[model samples]
Target chain A: MSHPEQAPEGRRRPASPTRALAEPPTTRTPETTRWRICREVIIHRIDDEAVAYDPGAHEVLYLDADAFEVFKQVDGTRDDAAIFLELAQQHGETTDEVASRFAPVLAAMRRHGWIGRTHGADEVS
Target chain B: MSTASTIGGRDVGPALDGYNPARRASCPAAPGPESPTYYRIGAVTVCLHSADARFREPFHHLYQRHYIGGPTLSAVHIRVDRVIRARPLGRGFRICVDGEERFLLRKPQAVLPHVEWAINAAVAATLPRYHQLHAGVVARDGFALVLPAQPQCGKSTLTARLISRGWSYLSDEFALIDPDTLRLDPYPKALCIKEGSFEIVDAFCPTAGALPSYEKSWKGRVRLIDPQALRPHRTPWGVPVGMIAFPRYVARPAPALHPLSRARALFQLLDVCFTFGRYRAATLDVLGGVVERAACFQLESGEIDATCDVLEAAWRAHVPASGRPDPADLTRPEEPVRPGVEAA
Candidate 1:
C-alpha cells in the first residue's frame, strides 16, 4: 500500500528467547522437540477461530479452528511428537496422519516465535 | 499567536485570514510569509500552512465543518506545509509535516493529496494510542463496515457508491479505532473518486464533474469529493464496527459477496492496519474485538449499483430485528430506553 504506514517501529517488548537458536523451525526440528507457548503471546478467540499476537516479534496471526486446537496443545510439558500422538489417539487417527496434518501448524507457530523449543521456554515475559 | 473564538455559536480556531503571517506554529517548509489554517478532524488537530490558495482553498472548502479560527486546546496535532521551489532542474513542492520534510512533489497540483498523505503519516507515526488502518470506513444505523485497503480493491469507488446510496461516510482512506472504547472513529476525509470510476460515480453525483481533478501517477486523476456534499450531516462520534469487507475489483457484470472466515478477515485487516507497528499488541487486541462481533466478507466489486446492493444486504443482515438505530441518526450508540419508556 502507498499509504502512510511507517516502517515498523522498533521492538519495545522483550525479544523472543528462541531467536538465536533457529532460522526456520524445520532446521531445528528433531524427534524430541518440546514446544512451549511464548510467555507474552496474547490470543483472542472468536467462535472456533482466533487471532494471535506476539508483541516481541510484532506479528499478528490468525488461527483457524484446527490451528487453534493445535496451538492450545503446546503447553511446554510435552514434545511435538508426543502431542501429535495424543491428538491422534483422541481423534482416532494414526500418529503419522496427525503429524502430517499438524506439523505445518507447529512449524508456523515456532517460525513466528509464538512457541519456542524446550530450553528457551523458561524465560519470563 | 492563535486565538479561539465562536462564530455562529460554533467554536473556531485562528483561521488564516485573521492570523498573523509572521507567527509560525509547527510546519516550517513554507518559504514566504505563511497563512496557517487549522482544522479539528475528530480528536486530531490538523494545521495546513501555505500562502497559496490552490492548497488552502480546497482544504477549507472540503473540510468546512472541521475548520477552526483558533489553535487547538488538547487534541492531537498534525501540521503540514508546502515549500514550492523553482530550481534549475524542475519546479516541485516539498511537503513537510511537523517541521520535517516528508515528501517532494513534482507538480503543484499534487500538493493537496500529498498534504492529506502527510497528515495520514503523522497520525500513523505520532499517535500510538489509536489503531490506524489504511482503509475506507462507512456506517449505517450506528454500525460501520470497514473496507480494508488492498491492491486494485477500489475501496474509494465503493465508498462513494455507499454514500450515494444513503450510507454515512466515515473516511475514504483510514479507519481510526479508538483503543479505549474499541469503536471505529471517523477519519471522514473526502471520498476520493479515481479517474477510472469517474463515470460510474458521476452518475450518482452529477455535480462532481464541475469539480477540478488532480493528477495522480498511477490513477491518472482523482477528484476529492466532499462527503458533506453527498450526505447532510456526519455523526461526530465513535461507532461500533459491524462488518469487515475486503473488496476486490472483478470485471464481471455483477457484484458478489462471499462469506469470509473471521480469522482470514483479521489477518487481512492486520495487513492493512497502518499504525499496527506503533500500537503493537494493543492493535491486535482492538482488531480482534472489532472483528469478533462483525460479519466478514470478500466483496467482488463490479458495477457500483450492484456492489452497493450486495453491501446493503450484508449490512441489513447484521442488524437486529428490533430497536435498530436510525441510519440517519446523527449521534450513535443510541441511549438505551429506560425500563418504562422502551415500548413507547
Candidate 2:
C-alpha cells in the first residue's frame, strides 16, 4: 500500500529556478485547469459529510459539506472556474469569492493525493 | 442412549460425577489425555481436559447447568495442566487449546478467572463466520432486543434484570447476526456480574448464593451467572431483531427512550462492531439492512425496572402485528436490503 502523502514514482518533479520563471502565468490559473478524483477512492455520503475510503491505503477520510461539493464537481470534465461558477450560483455568490474561499481546500486535496490534473489521469505512476 | 443423567429436563453427562482431580493429578502422564467434560452453548461446543485438581471443581460448578449430554461434537478443545518445574514464584498452570498455549497464570487460584477469559477468547475467534457485534441481547415473544453499548454502561446489569423478569437470555457479550439470513443467533454463555451489581442481581436470582464468584480480580469482584439456571430446558436459537437500543446508565429520576434515525443507528452499530473493517462494503450492506428492519433507540436510565419497562413497551410497539416469523423459517437466505443514505 502507498502512503497517502508520498507521490507516486516518475511523476513530475518541482521545477528549477529557470524553468519556474519560464512557465506561463495563464497556465497556473484555475480557469483553464481541470481535476480528477483518484481511481483508488470509494466515497459514501453521510449526512453533511462524505466518507472516502481508499482501498489502496485502507484509510477512511472525511469531507464536510463544502469539501464534498468540491469533490463532487471534480469529475475530470469541469475546470476549477466552472465548478466555482456552479457553486457560486447555488450559494448566491460571485465566482471570484467562491474561488478565494475554496483555494486552501483545493490545495489541501492536491497535497493529500486525492485529486490530480485531468491531463495526467492515465499517468498514475 | 448416552451415559449422562437428566437435570432440569436437560441431559448432563456424568463428567462431573467421575471428576477426581486428586487421583488424576497423582496419576502418571499418558501418551494422550482425553477430556472428560463436554458442553454445548448455542452453536459452539467446548471440550475441557484438566490435569490440575485446583481447576476441576470450579469449572464443574460453573458450567454443570449448561452441560449438553447428547452426541454433540466439540469445536474447541482445551487442556489445563500445572507446570512441573517450579519457578521462584512457585507452582503455575498454563491453558492450551488444541495443543497451542493460549494463557499462563502465575497462581493456581487464578486458574478459574483465566479459564473464563480463555473461553471467551475462543468463542470470539469462532464467531467470525457471522457478523458479530459487541452487544447484550435478550428476547421475548420471538422478537430479539439488541443492546449495544460501551463498557461500564450497565449493559450486563440490564440484561440480567431483563432475563430475571421473563425475557429469554440470548447473550451478554456478543450478538452474532447471520450475514446471509439477517437473523440474530443466541450465544448464551455465563453472564459476568461485577461487584456493585451483586445485591441487585442476587435479589432477582434465587440461586445467586450458590454460584461461584472470584474476589479482588482485575474487574473488581466478579461472578458468573449460568443463564440455563435462570431458564431451564431452553434451547438458545436465532431470532429476528425487533429493536436496537444504545443504553447509558445515568443518575436520574426516571428512564427515557429517545428515537434514533437509521443513519445514526448504523453509525453506532458500526462503531461497536468486532470485525466489520475486514468486510467493509458487505458489512455496511448487512448492517444497513439490520437498522432498517429494526427500530433504534437511545435509552438513559438509573433504575433497572423502569428501564426494562420502557424497553418492553418499545418492543411491543415496534414488532409487527402479524408477529415474527418462526425461527425454523428464518434459516433461508434473503436478499440484502439496499443501503439507505439518510441525512446526518
Say which candidate scores most in lDDT. Answer: 1
User: Over 4 Å off in model 1, which ranges?
Assistant: A1-29, A37-40, A94-97, A110-125, B1-35, B74-90, B217-219, B321-344
True-structure RMSD for candidate 1: 11.6
User: Residues B173-251, candidate 1, lDDT per residue (tens digit)?
Assistant: 8888888887877877777777888888788888777666776566577788888777677654688887778888889
Docking class of 1: incorrect
lDDT of 2 by residue, B68-109 (tens): 555455467778876645666465568887678887666554
Q: Any runs in candidate 2 off by more than 4 Å, and if so which? A: A1-125, B1-34, B69-74, B84-88, B215-217, B231-233, B324-344
lDDT of 2 by residue, A2-121 (tens): 444322221122223244234333324445667887657766554444556565554444454566778888888777888898889988999999887765456556655677776545
Q: Supply candidate 2's per-residue lDDT for A90.
A: 84
* Two-chain DockQ for each candidate model: 0.18, 0.06
The residue pairs found clashing in candidate 2 are A47-B344
> RMSD of each candidate?
11.6, 11.7
Q: What is the TM-score of chain B alone in each candidate?
A: 0.79, 0.78
